[model samples]
Target chain A: MKHLYPIKESKQCELRKASPETIRFLLDYSKSLKIVSSRGLTFESNLN
Target chain B: MELHVDDASLVKNYLNGDEKALECLIARHNQRIFNFIYSKVFDTEITEDLFQETFIKVIRTLKLGKYNEEGKFLPWVMRIAHNLVMDHYRKNNRMPRYEGSEQFHVFAILEDDGVNAEKRLIRDQIESDLGVLVDRLPGEQREVVRMRMYQNMSFKEIAERTGVSINTALGRMRYALINLRKFIEENQIVLTD
Candidate 1:
């Protein structure tokens, strides 16, 4: 089976193992593309 | 024998009013096109609409003799989707942002558990944690992951789209994976196999 989670074979393991706090921090960084996409007045998919 | 033709040839045939050729082309590329659009917007419904729109634009532009057959057909369609995504951002005057630092909070958009709130909460927590790590990556790395993993773009296509060397694109992916791995380890989160 093709592995979706192929561990990176690199020396920079420290950055790879982000703390839960750090993970939460990053999610907060980028705002929602949905809101932006919607506000742009483009066609929204009704399939959702 | 099923007449085999390259994408360009098929496109040209479609341009010449061979309607079946267009159908063949759509069958060949729809899933890839859908994945590409989904990666950019991160919404299944939006991706479906954009997927349809991408093909419509392809048909319209091809009929108008606006596309250059010098490049592969999928890339041209991808360019259309990319432009649409960019236009979306530009018109809204907003940036793509997610909340939290550790996991992906975007999963909240997927959950609705009146009876299983606890399960939903746990899943959301994990996603939020992972989302944070992914978000902290450098811009180039993040873009590469978005294209490669989310958009399902090939290294060649990504290089072409971003106007970067293929090696550079691959290197960005490599670094992105490395950083993500580190982020996971430091957080002591076990991703299920």
Candidate 2:
């Protein structure tokens, strides 16, 4: 359902016009976020 | 394939000992929470601590069955982040003032192509925060805001891409600004000197 939202224009979200400070902050924030978010991302089928 | 769970499912799975499920939940919304915190405090290290502390509080609440899922997990988590940032400020005797100090016009930064690299780099963090907030706007409104503000597109171009009339596109833009202003004010998102 979430992905069903017409994503044709979604490519636009990837277009970031960030400066070095923002780039640094985003890199750090995203790194930690990805680390935490990936916790159950590759789970075994029977885990549920 | 059949069990592509959502945030709520991941959260439930976490409560049931699927530790990874909680990870997925954090992964999904951590940036949003981080964006909110970073915008308020404008400090990366403090933002990281608040991010972890926010999740700690969230995990504790979930373990105690205090999480009532009303289908808005991210915003709830963001509110927690917002509160924690505020609490830290209060404890430390510092609070974010609104535009009273000075406003860093995000749009001006984009429009003026001749800006110095040093200033651009400095303002980039705030721009990133502003971008995150704009993205939080609902679907069409978000689309319009991005096209108009970030992309620097004319209203006509926005209307064409969005398949709306000029007036409709204008309406969305208007509403987007109104909502963005309200969100910034309510959240106390500040701009520095």
Candidate 3:
């Protein structure tokens, strides 16, 4: 049987180590979105 | 500086109109969430993909105003990551043994009570998001897409309504989808389930 969940004793994730590319993608995608309220008004995400 | 801002406050700020708060919240919790996901997947690439999916779900929930946020932001995010991890396992046919009810009860909560409601919520959000994307197209193309997609109109009906030929309406929808795909690609957005 294969080990489904492997444990690496030597590895640890550091703080805020998320890839910049992913963050940039998320931010860009977020900015493109606008939340629409029940009244039909669009709210820009206002990332700036 | 948001150095001392709490999760609830950040969440509230983001909901109210400050998108930077979301960026701050993600940065603040990135390491912990990243580690939690990395521990489960043990592959940086897979962890990154799941991490993006987790936050994509988070952003959708927030955009839909579905997040209750009773000061449990981190745990809520952890739970989302956990579900995505389980989904990954199930997808890959590598599901591990469940620890116990203590650890697995979330599956019950999510599947039993939330799946349908959450799916509906996501569907609505995607509809609205697609509306925004459609609005970016030229006027003729936008009308064709709206008629076909939102109104569920046939090409013949759309042509009659728009006073264009059926082939023209069909051509417009083709261009609309092409433009929408281009925009989605340029933005790197995942529009489908």
Candidate 4:
């Protein structure tokens, strides 16, 4: 019979280890893209 | 900051044909929104995708005069993201699980640590295990966990967003934690304290 593993308990550490810098970077990048996309600017023009 | 642009003003500008105001609003609120979503999904790629989708929805809705300025804008945007996440699960037929309520596993995005391949292998294993565990939660419980942890939404806000009573939202969260605890104990998983 195949053993069924209940969900592991170790996944919580990811929450604590998340750095503010990473959060900020992800947000900024997403926001930049959103702004560009909303303005109907292609990625190439936005880059330049 | 040159001027402290209030959310309402920024929104009003965006609604009144000032598109740059939308950029300012995004710049102002993106970090909190991203962090909120990331906390729930625990996957960088998905979080990034969801973040963009959230703003896109926000733009669409605002254009359609769907957003009410009476409520806080950040929380309102978060509510949209929360709904989208639920929609995502429904479409995929997969439930989300809380990362923190489970065994304690860490993913390090360290630079210049000079860590060997062994450490990286361990990290990969832990992340994989974590992902599987999160995938096993029931849909309702998973939604609660995601909103509470990722979005950092208050019970009241969650209640309002999901259209459930506050007690109902809290009860779901309670059961979610209880079930997660039982799963961990049964599996004999050792979480890092």
Candidate 5:
């Protein structure tokens, strides 16, 4: 009974209510993660 | 001033070494970015993961000054989201590949839900082996496989581009796949990518 749920037709997407705080957190996390992982730097170094 | 600022301007500001500029760009476009990820996964949890992954990659690329300011930023990030979704599927081993006509048909028949995940995993492992076998094909056959399978080109399109007849294009792909399967059986290659 499973089917492909085409997202275009469904209306309950999470984007409508994405908050500013969430955006900031994700951006910060992404930046820090990339810096730490790619440069072999410590998380503490990127946190600042 | 905020209402009039454009994406290119924000990108330039960010590239000029302004951190807040990147934040503003994300806030402006995060909704569309979120929606792009959600559209592919159809699961809130997975969408969240991919959305984050997409931005992480975007931020890294922008920081490296390789974002190509000439291109529109929204579509570029959307392309990132789409690729992240595929990578997610690939990591989960649910990304069905196009090995031949039957595999290409609607992404490998969707695999009956009744088939347990373990069975699907085994089958996918086999398919992955054939994926590696692709590189071993003869020049003409390899071109046909890449064009027809990965690029999703029709035999007619492949024929026109490769300067071969449709029949020849189809023949090459068929032989390529047949040879791959034979090689897999003959060499006991494990499919994993």
Candidate 6:
């Protein structure tokens, strides 16, 4: 749905554009997050 | 097959313990979300924090088993980022302002072809932000803006390529700038260094 827009301009409610470094850091940080399940199981995912 | 996985499936997989699913999801939407946050805060450090926090909230909601938006993942994440940006401004007690200390013309940077290396970095950053805004214009206006800014096309060339008179192309450009100004002012987006 976001890809449907022709201009790169972000819509009022839409998010747009990211730097490579930001994305890399976010992915790494996301990997460190402990995703806890409803059953109390905690898991870590490796992004590398 | 990884490229073909949609957002909803990815979210489902992430909730089911497939961490790679969230990776795929983040990769898919990171640019827009990052840009969205960057546009509001104007500072990379703040944008980085907000981006991370936005995803943190996302993970918390998903982990709680309360996820519901099936096809609206990007917008949902965008809403989170937007709220975080607003919260940041609220905490600082300052409305987000245009980045530069002086009056800066967005179109001038868009048209600048002789930028030095240092200026090139700033210009590129501005162009990227403007590129996102350019994508939001109506069809004809967007086409004119893209041709003039990206293709380096003259008004005559734009008229020929777009099959319209020079005046019509010029009118579209004018209107596009008006709309862009309105968006910038209304959103208080930081498009400059």
lDDT of 5 by residue, B40-149 (tens): 77766667667777777777777655688554988888888888887888877875544456436665656666868888888887667666788888999999999877
Find the candidate with the highest DockQ and give its number: 3
TM-score of every model versus the real structure? 0.38, 0.39, 0.49, 0.40, 0.46, 0.45
- Candidate 4, residues B70-184, lDDT tens digits: the string is 5489888889888877776786666544344245533333256676787777777766655565557888878887899768999999999889999999999998888877877
lDDT of 3: 0.85
Cα lDDT, model 6, residue B66: 69
Which whole-number lDDT from 0 to 100 does residue B78 have in model 1? 83
Cα lDDT for residue B123, model 3? 82
Tell me how far the alpha carbon of residue B101 in candidate 4 is from the true structure, in angstroms, after superposition.
23
**Which scores greater on lDDT, model 2 or model 5?**
5
Q: Which candidate, 2 or 3, would have the higher DockQ against the true structure?
A: 3
| Alpha-carbon deviation at B124 in model 1, angstroms | 45
Candidate 3 - CAPRI tier? acceptable
Rank the candidate models, highest TM-score first. Answer: 3, 5, 6, 4, 2, 1
Lowest-lDDT window of 10 residues in candidate 3 chain B? B95-104
CA RMSD, predictions in order:
29.8, 29.4, 27.0, 27.9, 21.4, 26.9
Instruction: Name the DockQ score for candidate 4.
Output: 0.03
lDDT of 6 by residue, B1-193 (tens): 8979889889988877888898788887777788888888777788878988898788877876667999889989999888898898897876644444457755546665676788889888888888888889999999999899888999999999999999999999999999999989988988776
Q: Write the per-residue lDDT of candidate 4 for residues A1-48, one digit (tens) a residue.
A: 224643464464333322455445433443443222456543312121
Worst 10 residues of 5 chain B by lDDT: B95-104
Highest TM-score among the candidates is held by which one?
A: 3
Predictions' DockQ, in order: 0.01, 0.02, 0.35, 0.03, 0.23, 0.25
Highest lDDT: give the candidate number: 3
Question: Which regions of candidate 3 deviate over 4 angstroms?
Answer: A1-16, A37-48, B94-193
> Model 2, which residues run further than 4 Å from truth?
A1-48, B1-4, B94-193
Poorest stretch of ten by lDDT in candidate 4 chain A: A39-48
Show the colliding residue pairs in model 2: A37-B27, A40-B20
TM-score of chain A of each: 0.29, 0.32, 0.41, 0.37, 0.38, 0.37
